[model samples]
Target chain A: MTSDILAEAMDYIDDDLISQAYSYSRGRPKFSKPLAVAALVAVVVVAAVAAIKYSDAFITAPDSGDSSTTAEYFGGFMPDKISDGELEYEGTPFTEKEISTFVEKNKYDLIGAIAAEYGDFESVYKISTSGYSHVNLGETNTLKYDYVDLPVCRDDEIIAKITLFRSDGGLSYTISVRGKAFDKYNSIYQGNLSAELAFFYYGFEELIITPTNHIYRVHGTEETLEIDRSMNYYEKYATEYNTFSYNELTDEKKYITVKPLPEEQINDGSAYTSSDIEEETAEAPETSTVRTVNIYVEDLMSEEIASVEWGSGYDLMLDRPFRVCTEAQKSEMLRFIENMKPTEAAEPVQYYGGGYIVRLVYADGTRASVVLMGGDQVYFETSEGESPIYVDTNGNASALAEYIVSLI
Target chain B: MDDTSIIKLYWERDENAVRETAAKYGKLCIKLSENILNNKSDAEECVNDSYLTVWNRIPDERPDYFSAFLCRIVKNLSLKRLEHNTAQKRNPEMLVSLDELQECLPSDNLPEKSFDARLLGKSISDFLRKQKEVDRCIFIRRYWYSDSVKAIAEDLGVKEDRISVTLFRMRKKLKIHLEKEGFCL
Candidate 1:
């Protein structure tokens, strides 16, 4: 046995497999303590900048260094004189008298410590409902909204509106004051309130902030209010970091040549085209005629696809197109495409070779064609006038390629 | 910095790319080399050489898996060093791992011109993909990284005997797979 040859052959092993072995053994890579600290500092700085830029009014500590100023502003302990404003609770408006009566009856703390401790209450009263359970992970995704807007009113004027934002690690409260309160509380001095506060002053339940999804269980009753915080999260964030283009590959770059299956062996099980075949100098014909807008692979809607077909230019046997038979398979195929990272294009020669081809026919009569190569790269097979585009599959293409090969 | 950012640095011809690569993957590359060469200085040298090769290769080849790409280089270089150092003296440490694979390899008598190391490697890779992740990891840890059975067991949190038995079964299965793929005589 040629053990030496076998030993050297280890070099060509798939990159993702190598990564999996390393990662499985080592677990996820962790930031060093210093790196973690640096990252935290950077996040804090960015948040501060964003707060200053976006917020109309900045809440500040009193110039006299007295916490009582904030205490007085929130009407500490004095339920009768807090404000003439009506505190809107879950669509039911309650006047200051009603709040004071409730506080008196319940023996609750009338002073809003959220204002005292945090040094300012922005006119906006923000409250996030509970996050939703992830369909795949079965864990609560700490996304902060499906936001319900509630206005804190002073007399007839709506002073603050609550805006909900999602948090994965924990619950957060950001109070922004507007109008008259904005003039009263807005200042240069800043204070940080990292924890979620439970107000005993009114009908509101204790806000539970947890690292997990088990948020806000009622004190005595078995009642639970679940909120879908992850609403539109994918539509908002996933596309931001994942968008890519094939403009990186230069004209001179060479791709692994894939050849059409031999004519005699087309549709037969034997003679799978080996990628080891020599490269031919011949260029692929300009077969692409479809023109698309600035659409990306991730932009393709699985529901809209009327048909999914896959074949290989290299394997003549698979030239008889294998249609995606199951909805699950179709979804899986689209999901894989969505996960592909934008990468540089290789030479347009891939359109001519042993590359795997997937054709998608949409219900609107739009057709899209993509080529998956042996190197775990994918490219949009363009038309006669369009440039070929490539994307990095990050090994997702291999899974897709395996699925396509399985059909054969 | 992320791998893409580091790769961009290389493409931009920034020298800091080497520093970043060393900072991020230096330990992994060294450990992989040490597993094979068994000499600390030689392993370090191999890792450094691998970094330089990465510096030169990138911009031309922006690897998606930067760690794997670097580790492969370090492993190859260490193997070359091992071959040179063991010309007169066989290193039993590495030989143990290779000998285990000897049972599954196809006939070595095929003419040199007929052997495509890459095709064989691709075949092995394709076969490995079909196995369970743990079994695949064990096979790669032992053969690709030249890790000791005890080390593999420790890394995987399994018994050394379990690793041994799994490797044995995997080799037999691989032989059958290769024979079916027409790689064996």
Candidate 2:
């Protein structure tokens, strides 16, 4: 068994696996813009400039004292008009009526926010399409839509693929306690998340949420989202600080606490920004083919692994759940078990009737009482731990164990 | 420099908008599409399509995260192309896989209760990470790290019938697992 252990893992690497992951043979998606590098570099530059400029403006109150005229333009006093939990738009640099009108005009993303406070009046009536903007995630996908030409609104998510344009009359969308976002006074606000808004306002990267789907790129770290009114959100989202009312705070004025949505539930796929929009198909003829490249992994480099069965005397000593299998498969599994460091191996043993307990030993001193059914149903698990080792993020597993009374 | 400004550059008919986008999300798009299509030409097509999609859709729409926005388009385009190719080839697995999701995933009729594609994807990943030893091995052997049931079972020394039943139950478990995570969104 020991001799066989060293060679087993080497046999498993399968050159096909690497190629499959690398080549995307199973109809995976590809991003192929010839000038992507230049685009990325420019984005960095732009982000830097926006960061520096907005950061400076956001930290100071836009209407700290000298800007009374600017204060009157934004209608910012509305926050005082509403009581606890009541949703209102008056005095809020953004008006409810404005978003409703925006949605009505575009009529592409037929999704309307059922006012969390007042169910009667639909909030943000902007945009629609009978299609009702939607998103569908499958086995292989990690995405966030932004700066797109389309809007997605559905019962589950409100994903706006396009970013708010500053040169336009629109403000970036704003979120209230009522669970909704709206962009009014286009160019006044950019419609980023509270965190993004904070960064935009404060000029500090302290508040931006990296997003969940991006966690893979961030090495799977789960980060929490933060938002506070002490930060002037308007400065980052609003292109024109004057969009706020007398009392409303702009980048240089006062800080209003903003609560970011719960990080756990934020659909990163729904995040969008303006500059990112040009990346999508822009008014070009549909001459480019539309498609998705999902790696089926199952289609390429499939190889047969040996299956094993537990011989007689395995039924009596077993406790709760039990399964059976062949010797060949068992040997192969045992070899795999031996390959793992001692700390990783499951305990191996063969339980028999009539008071006889025999622990099966692998060549590498690995012991297991595992049961493998016939064919390739290999059940390799550790009784000591809660989770098994071979599963990937998409719920893929290494094997399962089931007890079989008879042979096929 | 702002994505908002750059998008405006496009709507205002500025070609430098293309240069800006290329500077920001080009490699990410190229890599993503390339991973899916395997062919550079097809990958390029998907990326360009993504660009076109963004361009035509932006006037009435506003997004906060451009990378995610672009990624979704590229991914969807690539998947659509892949589906077309696979359908032309008459692959039974595609139909079976899709049919299996009919009961839980999004479709034309289901709205009030639908699954979060991203969360579901994550839940599946989480579930895989939680599987017990033998079960985990079987899963990897059948899905990710490996390919087919026959190969997985052969590697593990299990009967084909046993493997089939286990696979069935595994699928069932996955459905149940998703439900537990509020996959209905």
Best by TM-score: 1
**Fnat per candidate:** 0.50, 0.00
Task: Encode model 1's per-residue lDDT on B1-185: one tens digit a residue.
Answer: 77888999999999999999888777778878888777788899999999889888986998988878888888878878987885544345567888888788766677655657788789889989987566688888888777888877655433365466667657866887888788788
What's model 1's interface RMSD, roughly to a tenth of an angstrom?
11.7
lDDT of candidate 2 over A253-321, digit per residue (tens)? 222111222222222423212232222323322332111111111212213212221211111011001
Stretches of candidate 1 above 4 Å error? A28-408, B87-91, B108-114
- List ranges where model 2 is wrong by over 4 Å: A1-408, B1-46, B56-65, B75-172, B179-185
- Please give the lDDT score at residue A116 for candidate 1: 23
Candidate that would win on lDDT? 1
The B-chain TM-score of model 2 reads 0.50
Per-residue lDDT over A40-123 for candidate 1, one digit per residue giving the tens place of the 0 to 100 score: 333322333222221112111111122222111121121211122222121122233432232222111111212222233332
Q: How many residue pairs clash in all the candidates, one count each?
A: 17, 182
* DockQ comparisons of all candidates to the true complex: 0.20, 0.01
The local distance difference test score of model 2 is 0.32
